[model samples]
Target: MGIVRLIDRQGNRHELQALEGWRVMEILRDWGMFVPPRCGGSGQCGMCHVKVAEDWSGKVLPPGELEAKVLPLLPGRGETSRLSCQILWSETLDGLTVALP
Candidate 1:
């Protein structure tokens, strides 16, 4: 398992315990964060957008083809923008930090 820290739009910080191989969105939703998995983690909806913290951005897995197609369409997308539903938890991301965009 790993720790995933999230900052909401209002600047509220939340930390969640995430299991390996689980999607980031799954962990966030399980913790009752405000992430809207409108597409049920299928990467069809852009509601699960989150920006990886700069320090850990480089460590995050690269976006897949589906995410690449959807992320740019969302408002406020940045270099660190990612679809949480598509991010798998891993030891390398133990202290990962992300913020709702």
Candidate 2:
């Protein structure tokens, strides 16, 4: 299991273990985090957007067609903008931080 920290909009931090093969959004939603997993996390909606910290932002990302479409619609589109629903857990991301904007 990998532990990932999610800093919510109000700056509250919640630590959770990323279930194997589960997207960050799903983990958050399962843990009762505020992320809206609308569009079934298909990347059709930008509801699952999360901001990766400077360090983790540069890491390799999960790829998908819907992920590409949703990234541009997020609040702060950046080189690291990602739909949480698109990200899959891996060992390298155990201590990753994601800020919910």
> Which structure among the candidates has the greatest TM-score?
1
> What is the number of residue pairs that collide in model 2?
0
Give the Cα RMSD of candidate 2.
1.7
lDDT of 2 at 9: 84
Specify the highest-lDDT model's number.
1
lDDT of each: 0.91, 0.79
- The digit string of per-residue lDDT tens for model 1 on 44-95 reads 9989999999998889879999999999899999999999998899998998
TM-score of model 1 vs. true structure: 0.94
Off by over 4 Å in 2: none
Q: Assess the local accuracy of residue 99 in candidate 2 as a C-alpha lDDT between 0 and 100.
A: 82
lDDT of 2 by residue, 18-84 (tens): 8677878888888888647668877788888888878897674755776776677677777677888
